[model samples]
Target: MYESVLVATDGSDSADRAVDAALDLASVFDATLYAVSVVDTRRYGDSALSGTEDIVSDLETQANELLDAVEKRADGGVMTELRHGKPHAEISDYATAIDADLLVLGNRGRESGEVIGSTAERIVRFVDRPVLTI
Candidate 1:
């Protein structure tokens, strides 16, 4: 019954699986697919003026390329997005902004009741939409 599905990918194998799952769900529901890749801006120091632009540009290019590849593999009704920010915050905001029916993501080896990584756990906590972790 999903109308719009958002899948966040990091070009990892787990994320690839999540993409496949989202694609299958989209196909079944006749839903539109939105693929997002977030470039973590925290990796760069705020005061580092030298080479920061080039580094950020390269990261953006890489993120775009990854999203493009995923979109190519998806069916016709797919859109790609590349964002720069904390991964969880950006993804959650995007889902809300786009009124997504569901947000899909891949678990990066986190166990139940244990501390999940900040990104994945925060996403689960912050996003109002249902999250399907593959």
Candidate 2:
């Protein structure tokens, strides 16, 4: 009975899997699929480094590309967004803002090394919605 399915992706392998799963669920439920890619600006800190702007620009570009790939793979029926912030916070807030019926995410992202990625773990704990981690 899901009406809106939101998936967060970082262009990582596991995120890709999550995308596929989200697509399947959306298709099955006839739900609208929404995809998001966050630039993780927190990693850059608040310092005014010389190349900080360039680095953030590059990250933004990558985020757009990742969102583009997801939309392309979805065959042009998905809504997408690019955000600059902490992954967990951005994603969870987005889910709530969109009133998503379900939130899907990768078990681990690019920076993950433990049993579960910190972002996914945090989202699962904090987001007040059902999360399906792939």
| Best-performing candidate as measured by lDDT | 2
Q: What TM-score, computed on C-alpha atoms, does each candidate reach?
A: 0.88, 0.95
Candidate 2 on 85-119: residue-level lDDT in tens? Answer: 88999998899889999999999998778778999
Q: Per-residue error at 120 for model 2, in Å?
A: 0.6
lDDT of each: 0.82, 0.91
Off by over 4 Å in 2: 48-51
Please name the candidate that would achieve the greatest TM-score relative to the true structure.
2
In model 2, the number of clashes is: 0
Give the count of colliding residue pairs in each prediction. Answer: 0, 0
Tens-place lDDT per residue, model 1, 75-127, is 45688888887888899988988899998887752223444556777888878
lDDT: worst 10-residue window of model 1: 108-117
